[model samples]
Target: MGILDGMTPKKLIIWILLAIGIGIVLFILMLYLTLKTKTTSLERITPYKESLKRELVTLRPVHIFELMEPTKSNYTYAMSDTNQYYFQVLESETGADIPLTKLKDSIPAGATIYFEKAVNYTNGVSGSSTPRFFGTISYKEKKYPIEFVWGRYTYKSHPENLRPGFTMDLAPWNNRVDTTIYYLPRGSF
Candidate 1:
């Protein structure tokens, strides 16, 4: 009562309106500043598009079938209790044996390999063949792995079981041909 004694209803209404207007202005200013800061931070973290293009050109393409084979080592029994699998040396299309140690050098950076047929067994019993694609990319003198599969049906299999240091490609949905490359961190193979 004492504080409002000198203020009429009209003055009180004007004061309230002014305070609201000031608050709205301050809020907008704060929002704008926050968004600007986030935008700048994002720009710093993302790679430049041009640099990515230049790096991609360094990769070479190889056929997966040429580098892999249906040997026992390449075969895996899905849905098995023990996750049992065998390891055999992969071979190139020329019938030359490709040692596991030479995989990194055989497929250079930016190289592509097509795995038309992969050996897989369902229920740890019956074998079914699958198709896959593989590639390698190098950035900053370090190689990043890449892989692609023919369909989603085989995508859910244990990718972790893949040899360390290799990358796999993934599709968003089952039966979709489009693929997105996924890179594993070092030692995540």
Candidate 2:
């Protein structure tokens, strides 16, 4: 009867013990905001750094003087400035004959005797230019072709005399090269 008509049972047990102490302080503030949002996401993240440091520089191949394959690969454009050099030797395993005087008096100006890959047809700059040195063939990955032979003569003058039976016949060398292309390292800019 309205708790005995506005009566007191000790004010209805002190309003049910102040509503059970505000529901135990809102369940301990919801378990302290769920453990402070998981320790602030495991203290954010920042530790593991070390970047930037490169050196790269290692290339080879550059041998010249050995021609014979021009029936129609295209040629004849000489005006005279003198600097031709386009050698491509890669046919020596045992077919016999490779004597151009055992390579003109210890050749080494840009020597690559035979790796097969040459290009440098010049006049002022029409196509292949920059650095160009040559050599480097792997097949799956690596093709540094550029044995230089544009206008010709990379710079040759030392040949006082030594032409002994210049034969050099590796059986028309042609190591099979469809396309790989890569020549840049004479000066490199």
**Candidate 2 lDDT, tens digit per residue, 49-79?**
0000111121232232332332113321111
Q: What is the number of residue pairs that collide in model 2?
A: 13
Worst 10 residues of 1 by lDDT: 77-86
Give all candidates' CA lDDT scores.
0.31, 0.27
lDDT of 1: 0.31
Backbone collision count in every prediction?
15, 13
Tell me the tens digit of each residue's lDDT in model 1 across 42-151.
Answer: 11111111122222342333322223322234331111001111112222223445333223333333432222222121211222222222333434454434432322
Q: Over the full model, what C-alpha lDDT does candidate 2 score relative to the true structure?
A: 0.27
TM-score of 2: 0.16
